[model samples]
Target: MLNGKVVAITGGFGQLGVAVVQGALAAGAKVAALDRAPAPAAASNLGDALALGGLDLAEPDVAARALDEVARKFGGLDALVNIAGTFRWEELEQGSVDTWDLLYRVNLRSAVSTSRAALPHLTRRGGGSIVNIGAGAAAARAAAGMGAYTASKAGVAKLTEALAAEVKDRGITVNAILPSTIDTPANRADMPKADFSRWVAPKSIADTILFLLSDSARDITGALIPVSGRV
Candidate 1:
């Protein structure tokens, strides 16, 4: 569905990020996988997708340089998936104020920086899509100990709407996927007793993101689609 299009994914070394990269490549897109972690040897499994590691996407200059590199390498950029976010479960009273700051930078600011950097390239190509990974819990309601995380993700949801409206006239569409309890290794390790089957799979979310990037979803913008699986 993404034939010959260039797609860049942030947090590309993580489980979910890898799934998105593989899906996009399978759909005939050239992908640039950017992550804060060093490129793992297993990155070879991504076929020919470009792997750019050790990136601090929250920094505007860093994001700009990384995205500019992707555009230069791929001739231009068509879509971007902002999946570089961190989560922390902490009640406001028990958690340090630093936790809130950290989550805000990692979860919300990174998307803002990266999307801003990708705008020129996408506009130059006449149109593009941006898919942000938001938390379903955040969008619906925040539970106890989820203040910082939910607040950060809520910022992402708002960013999706504001950016979508800002770029609508430029043929750019921005949307977000709100997933509940993604079935990742980290989540499984963190909640061993939880019902894993109820959680959404990384591949499932990746497929949804690809659909948003495809022409089929060209008219869909500022949408916060919920992908909660059985959860």
Candidate 2:
């Protein structure tokens, strides 16, 4: 479904990000994998299937540089998946301003900076797609120990909506996936006793993102689709 497309996936070294990259590559899209960490071992499997880069999406200039580098390397940019995020589990009483700021930088500002940087390149391509990874916790009422994380994701949701509106006329489609609990290895390890069967798989979410990026989803924008699985 993604053949001949050039796709940029942020947080490409992460479990979910890697799955998305692999899926896109399998579907025949040229992929650029960007993350804050150094390239991961998956690059070997990608061979010419992927290009990897280190990027700090919180810094606007760095984000711009990363986008420029991707465009230059890939020859063009068609889709951007903002999957980079940090999870902070802390109570309001225990969470300091620093904690809030840290989450804001990673979860909120990073998306904003990267999206801003990718806009022109997407426009140059005559239109592209942006899929943000959001959280279901953002839509639900706040939990006791997730104030900062929830707030940051709420910001992401709002940003997705606003950006979609801003770029609608330009032919860019911006959307978000609100996942409740992703069944990643880390999550399974963190909660070994919990029911992992109900959690959404990374590949499943990646498929939804691929669909949103496809030409068939041209009319879908400013929408936050839930991918909770059975959770």
Candidate 3:
């Protein structure tokens, strides 16, 4: 259903980010993958699609140029998925206030930068979709050491809701997917003894993003859909 469409993903080289890129390819869309650091060799699977590295998406001008590059390459952009973010396990009790600022830039500012940049291209296409990666932790009562991460993601949820309303008449749909403990290699390494089976799979999250970007979900804007699986 995504044939001929162009979709861009930020944080597009990470565990879940790669999954979303592969998912978009499977749906026949052209994908642009951007990251704050260079993608590993594994990302060669993207095979000539747009891939940018070391971009500070926290900077609005850089973010805008990235999207402009996509449009220049693809003629137009159809979807944008804000997946660039960071996770810090720090608590108010002993964690440094510096973590709060770092999380704000990596999580909240990244989304704000990308979404603002993509808005014009999406609008130029006559209509499109924007998906933000929100944490389930942001919705529930945050865990003890999750304040920084949760607060930033809460900002993402609010961005999705407010942007959806702002673009209601412009045919753009903004939504966020909230996932609980995505089962990445990094997460597994950190929680070696945890029940991996209960965590959401990257593919599942990618599938949810596909649904939101597809025509089937045209009416599903301003929603924060959770993809916890059995978690």
TM-scores across all candidates?
A: 0.98, 0.96, 0.97
lDDT of each candidate versus the true structure: 0.94, 0.89, 0.92
Name model 2 segments beyond 4 Å from true: 41-51
Per-residue lDDT tens digits of candidate 2, residues 136-196? Answer: 9999999888899999999999999999999999999999999989998889888899899
Clash count per candidate: 0, 0, 0
- Candidates 1 and 3 compared: the better one by TM-score is 1
Clashing residue pairs, candidate 1?
none
Model 1 alpha-carbon drift over 4 Å, by segment: none
* Alpha-carbon RMSD to native, per candidate: 0.9, 1.3, 1.2
> Clashing residue pairs in candidate 2, if any?
none
Q: Which candidate number maximizes lDDT?
A: 1
